[model samples]
Target: MAKVIEVDPEGLRSWIGSAKRTLTIESEAMARLIQALDGPLGRAFGEAIRLIKQGSGRVIMTGMGKSGHIARKIAATLASTGTPSFFVHPAEASHGDLGMIGRDDIIIMISNSGETAELRAVLDYAKRFQVKMIGLTSRADSTLSHHADVALCLPDCREACPIGMAPTTSTMLQLAIGDALALALLEDRGFNAAQFKTFHPGGLLGAALTHVKDFMHKASQLPLVAPTTPMAEALVTMTQKSFGCLGVVDGESGELIGIFTDGDLRRHMSRDLIDLTVSDVMTRTPRTIVSDTLASEALEILNSTKITSLFVVDDKNRPVGLVHVHDLLRHGVQ
Candidate 1:
């Protein structure tokens, strides 16, 4: 058995107040960063983008302490988007990692104060090797900025910490800048979702981008019947295929002319369903999708039309495949 401690209302109120104040301060800092982006900061960003895009080499990100963590994330974002990039520890660069930096590669060095000791070795190496360096720092006059090919000076803003020492607000601004650069490069390179999917497979994103043809039932699995086939035979084909529907194609032209679904069966319950031909019971001009259509798009069709399955056809409207909502759901597509 555990003893329940009495709650302190006053203490809890103070904690909430502190948290709100921290959020307000950080929010204001981000607002200021947005304003700074419209000024000289925007120009510096443009220059960085131009240099990185024009170069054939990758972006080498390096930083110290908290900035190092931010740099690693920025590198990952850049790499996944379109621009190739990787993070190298400043201290590690001094101990043989400098070999990773090629002459064509550009270095993005992050330092809030622009005077990190470990970063000096990387700066010196960049200078010696003639590698382009972009410095992200608050102080424009600091050593890092002095040696940089392009100095992206951060706005003059204090940390959100109560003591004004911790890296709350500054790190937020750094991350915002990094994100801005990555998105800018992504747009400039025309990185479409298909290209992004290649790098982001094996997750919800991969499922969303998966093409219909990838998981759709191919021709052999499709429950297909000639337009002249009896409804009884078509029902058997539909049952055996287990897709709850049968595509009606013209035997002469091999073109899909109609579809017979379970819903159609219900609507014709008053008629002699078994003796009828598929052409008499089927719904003409049924909804269809192409083989290259995305599974997500097919889901949209199923949702909008209030149907469970769709016929996957070719350019000539020949039924090449069939896709069910269950197929999309089973493939982890929503």
Candidate 2:
């Protein structure tokens, strides 16, 4: 049988208090790091960004132990933000992976102590190849910092762990610095959302960034009627298209002029609706979108206006396509 130990309320309270203290310590450490950014550390950050931006090769990040985990994340962030980077295990470099390092590439070595044994081979290879090296370390006098072309020395801060051994606050600072570097590079390169969408084109984010033209109903599928057409005929077009709405266009200019919807039908039900022309009942100046508009934007309009459909128009205001909220939802635009 499993042991059934009695719960201790006082012990639980003490655990909670310890957890809060850890969080408070780490928070204060990060705040000190922010304050340190305006000094020599700030100049070092700027120089690192300049070197990486001017280089014609990718950034090669290498580390060991806990720093290795942070290195992987930093590499991923740099790659996804248009920096072209990848993480390499220092242990792997000793065996044969050192061949992956190019003379043109910039090496970023991460180590809290700046003396991780596994990193020695990679650092030697970088030096021999004459590759530029950037060191992210807390110890400025350590071997990694001594060999690096640029050293981003972290501010002096104790670990959040009560024993002061495990990497707690140090890892947080490393991650933050990595994020800062990636964002700075992204801004310097003027990386736009369109380029970002290109990199992230396989998930909910990709679906959300889809353009309106990709899923909109084209001219053949659009329910359209002339402004002078009888409301009875417009209703037939609406039903045939099965979009619950009809775009009213000018017969001479082929330009969109108004829209007739199910709501309009309900509003005019008490009048001589059948005898009215589309010009008499249709709503003028209906909302519209261009082919280049994002599907997410169209979704926003539909939700904000509580309307079901929008006409996609060309430069001359001619109806070229239609975008229904259902179409957007079907394509996962939301």
Candidate 3:
């Protein structure tokens, strides 16, 4: 790799200015793309959607080079948003990956010039497999678009690169078109946030937005101690449960009367812990949340109060489960 030369601040500023001017040009180009969404493009979009709705198998997206990257992103977006879609590298199609596509699948191929030699194999495979084809290309008259069932003709736009060599504006248009397709499919399928969580459950944003009931320990998992219980046994109860706390319940009614936390244990260190009863040390009516609460609301309580856990209760203040900070952490909560 060649080393970059250090230049004056003003010299760097001029290059940055040129980049900004290029972005303005791209923005204008995107606006023109919307304006160019005339009768033909609308018909193509409608036909593509009809094909997708009628199809039973997945959507197979393929493209060459940078268009391939955009195609892969579109495939991922579609897959995660309830539309069954996957990417097949056009170059690899010639190398036996073409066998992975099925006749029931709809082939969506992308290319800027729409004349990649490698993509030709996938185009051929589409015909051989009897798969319907949709072309996302700038040139409507290009080979890839000519034989397609639907052609999403991109507007002829200048590149955002200073030399007009990079795939900036075209890639953006492809990505925007993919987004439009995905959202249209999402609405058609009636995809909801709950369904979205099923696809994206490995992140803090997913956990934080999830329902508290999903992570709360319930039934036999709950650790409850009667308020009349000795502090000596309550200490063991709180420790064994590993919740750093114990729900102090009514011996007869089984209703949560108080809570004995690790902090509460510390407060009573001055007293003989073994001699004191949970009734004497436990704090009455500790912080609690209903089972119907959202994890986001629980997170707000945890963050603002800097508390590690909350007691899960019923409408009548009966202990149903225990929610811990560790449980949230395990579920990818922030």
RMSD of each: 2.5, 2.8, 5.1
lDDT of 3 at 219: 82
Alpha carbon lDDT of each predicted model: 0.91, 0.90, 0.86
Error of 3 at 327 (Å): 4.0
Query: On TM-score, who's better, 1 or 2?
Result: 2
Q: Model 3, residue 41: what's the lDDT? A: 77
Ranked by lDDT, the better of candidates 1 and 3 is 1
- TM-scores across all candidates? 0.90, 0.91, 0.72
Instruction: Please estimate how well model 3 matches the true structure, expressed as its whole-model Cα lDDT.
Output: 0.86
Task: Give a tens-digit lDDT track for model 2, residues 174-207.
Answer: 9999999999999988997678878988767787
**TM value for model 2:** 0.91
lDDT by residue (1-334, candidate 1, tens digit) is: 9999987999999999999988999898888888988998888888998889878899999999999999999999999998899999998888899999999999999999999999989999999989999999989899988999888988878887999998988888899899999999999879987888888888877998899989888968989999889877888898999999999998888889999899998989865788988999899998999988887889999999999999999999999999999989998887
Q: Note the clash tally of each candidate.
A: 0, 0, 0
Q: In model 1, which regions exceed 4 Å deviation? A: 1-16
Worst 10 residues of 3 by lDDT: 200-209
lDDT of 1 at 194: 81
Considering TM-score, which of the candidate structures 1 and 3 is the better prediction for this target? 1
